[model samples]
Target: MTALPDLVLFAKYPVPGYAKTRLVPALGAAGAADLHRRLAERTVGILLQAGAPVEVRFAGAEEAAFRQWLGDGVRLIAQVEGGLTERLIDAARDHPHIFFGADTPDLDVGVVASARAELQNHDIVIGPAEDGGYYLIGMRQARPELLTDMPWSTDAVLRETLRRCDALGLGVALLPTLADCDRPEDLARWPQLEAPGRCA
Candidate 1:
């Protein structure tokens, strides 16, 4: 029997000027950071609701600060030093890990439940994002080829990732498509505040 994948949530420290910088033009440094913090909290709540262990591998702040920000019941760890891709490869070292991002807080518990089950049968499970990236990804082993030298934060992210998976003949399971709050204008696309929406 395969072990349940570890639930690893990736997030930032939400420090002004560093977190959510892309939205700074509209929300200011502080405001964008605040939004970033709130988004993470929302995702935390969703994980709690799903009855899944909350382990956050984060950047920008210490575990103590994250404890205060995210509240209790979450295990926080510092992300390995380096760029996103590097950190991803390191995280992938642990087999059977389901990686979730804080940006997609609107995720419903059902999606998480499904991802867990799919990981048992597939080499990877992807929760596609409207922006062409993925909100969630689960993998059974470290496949550095899928993590390195890829166009991250681009509309081709999902497409390119799938292409690589195909080239490697990896079994992939896809979940529902969702949106991520990346830009100021896209804030309107945020579903009504509800614990019921799919975590995008």
Candidate 2:
């Protein structure tokens, strides 16, 4: 069997007051953390069910806790100290990788498969998020600089990333846009997850 490309899920340890801060005003610290945990767990479950080889690259928690939370049979890597861009660059180096955030519950197996397929022919593949960031990014080869010095949490992220790709002469493929759970307004977009106790 051909070796599968790496699937990396970038997440923070779901700690109250640290995880999903934007949603705290609405969900409270503990509630927001619970939601974060649910989303990350759900994302991992979806990929595992699809039999996609995955690695959890995380910060703010230890491996033992993550293992207990996420269960066995998954590789866990501690994120190095840095901003999101720096960590992503380190993870994507030296391998073909498909990277995604844990907040995007709408990201299904099909989307991930599509990204892997596209990476076979394209240098980069991206799934645009409704909020102007991307939900997924895949690269056949390490191109860390492509992620550097850009707007991190703004609507222009997708556009800026594409612009960077162009400047680097990287061929790109874009997948369907999806919504991620972030701000309180975004909760309206996911009715199933909006109800109290639903995410738990």
Candidate 3:
């Protein structure tokens, strides 16, 4: 039997003062959190269109809270305590799975399809974010070293990850560059959140 494709979504629980903190200076506390929740919802809705099983591994909230937010029907998994890399490692069990965070509001099914298709030939696939980070990562198997300690939230993230992939001899495929909502300037990427001073 063919193995099913898994899509792991790493998301924050949208708690005020915890989620989308960088945007809080502009969107305020509750607004930023609310916006994150909406963005995550949009991402989940889009992923569901791919007709593949999506496991939502979340941080900053409990299972019941996630169910209440994303719905009881969604497959919700709590993220293990640690930094981003460790949490990512925890969710790397599903073979040929593509994992992404909830910050990219415009994520669509085509990118997902491309990632899955690219994984057929490449050992890993990564979608670069315009901000120098990555929007998604697709892997054929768990490769913890590929996700080890490194500079995160910087333009060097994508570059350093590629370097590590080379060091590990993992063939990687690159996807189209996308944007994620993490700061006030990044809000411009999404139309609804682009109005000046709206969040301030």
CA lDDT of each prediction against the hidden true structure: 0.82, 0.86, 0.83
Tens-place lDDT digits, model 1, residues 129-192: 9889999988988788888998998899899999999999999999999888888777666644
The runs of at least 3 residues in candidate 1 whose Cα sits more than 4 Å from the true structure, single-residue gaps closed, are 191-200
TM-score of 2: 0.94
lDDT of 3 at 35: 84
Top TM-score hit: 2
Please give, for residues 76-191, the per-residue lDDT of candidate 2 as tens digits: 99998888888988888566788888998788888988888888888899999988999989888788777888789999999988988998899999999998899988888787
TM-score of each predicted structure versus truth? 0.89, 0.94, 0.91
Error of 1 at 75 (Å): 2.2
Q: Give the alpha carbon lDDT tens digit for every residue of 125-169 in model 3.
A: 999998888999988889888788878778999999999999889
Which has the higher lDDT value, candidate number 2 or candidate number 3?
2
Off by over 4 Å in 3: 194-200
Model 3 has an lDDT value of 0.83
